[model samples]
Target: MAEENFETGDAGASQTFPQQCSSLRKNGYVCMKNRACKIVEMSTSKTGKHGHAKVHLVGIDLFSGKKHEDICPSTHNMLVPHVKRKDYLLVEIENDGSLSLMEDDGHLKTDLNCPNNELGKEIKDRYENGEVLTLTVMTAMDEEQVVGYKLDNK
Candidate 1:
């Protein structure tokens, strides 16, 4: 099989956009507590006298996996993050815990570091074992990190 060229598809993608709180739904990306998060639960409070309806949101940080909650007026706007994911072929791992990943077009990116967690340990272990790996990276709110990986038969 030919190598898949991962594309952004979202041409001219921006970091974030303003969206009304009432429109957000579960499993969607949002910016809460100044972090990019995935909306897990949402509830709406009835509007009281001389007040607007309120939306309560519970989300998990996309990068850190920490819970965050926020409440906003239904009609008020909140920052919604432009979440993006891409897959890259692993080329090599540097001694300093950096990843040498190859873009679909064959350009090597060496900026991202190996995650300091179980996944990072797994990546290191598999790389050391000489298994081909494909890594999925997530980018949002101007931040990027490795989120998952798969073994490659190539």
Candidate 2:
């Protein structure tokens, strides 16, 4: 008979081999590649009969504010989660409903809710202080580029 070693501790159970992944899933242990991810949802599978189980995870990007989901691995190595990096900073807030964002390369300002541009109803709310907004991505420019524009016709 083959000797199997299953380690259990404060983190639950620890399996030293790959075949033991099914067991880890049954015990409610989900593997994570990015520990820094903000877990928005955690769901377990109800299909396990003896030693087959799985977990699902849904997470959001702290920087870009995007959502993503994936299946949990049974016995995989977990990597450290990358921290959300802020490439831009909120600078001066204009009198109008627009604001300026300063990054390492440039400045960006826009009135997303302004009328006559979108050809319809107003979409953007008036800019406010301490509001973290995701600026439009200008992939064509380099990181050192600085941008300056006006919200209203000036």
Candidate 3:
């Protein structure tokens, strides 16, 4: 018998949990090479003389947009990360680069930094032009980043 360790994704304290490699589905979250990623593709191989069937997975980082791949036995367990996304109205972009965001529930968050990417530049540009912006932020594995923005239909 093998000793297995698992963490429950409770209250955001823990960000990942263990699941059998074969049970994973495409587009689900997985930990690849120590980075939390979104599975983009998956494949399986037949059982071999060495052990159980093998599973191949390719994933992209939810935060940094990096690619990672891993192979594991179907019967073995792998860590799957829990990902969450939220949208907030842009209140202000501090000179220090932190974003002051307001939630729909009237909560204010000022800890997230404005990313130094194209999206970040766009956010600042639009805000300076007096446009209301809704930013999408994704959180996982104790990390958070701006992923995208929502377009106003009105």
Model 1 ranges with Cα > 4 A deviation: 1-13
In the range 53-148, model 2's lDDT, one tens digit per residue, is 565766654333366566754444433222223434445545563545666667454432222233111223323433343433221111111122
Question: By lDDT, highest first, what's the ranking?
Answer: 1, 3, 2
Clashing pairs in 1: none
Off-target runs (Cα >4 Å) in candidate 3 are: 1-13
lDDT per residue (tens digit) for residues 89-138 in model 3: 88999899999999998989998999889999988898888888899999
Model 1, 57-128: lDDT tens digits are 999999898999999999999999888799999999999999999999889988899999999999999999
Model 2: lDDT equals: 0.39
Write down the worst ten-residue block by lDDT for model 2: 139-148
> Clashing residue pairs, candidate 2?
34-81, 35-81, 105-145, 106-146, 107-147, 113-124
Better of 1 and 2 by lDDT: 1
Candidate ranking (TM-score, best to worst): 1, 3, 2
TM-score, candidate number 2: 0.31
Question: What value does the lDDT take at residue 127 in candidate 1?
Answer: 97
Query: Which pairs clash in the backbone of model 3?
Result: none
**Candidate with the larger TM-score of 2 and 3:** 3
Q: How close is candidate 1 to the true structure, as a TM-score?
A: 0.88
Poorest 10 consecutive residues by lDDT, candidate 3: 4-13
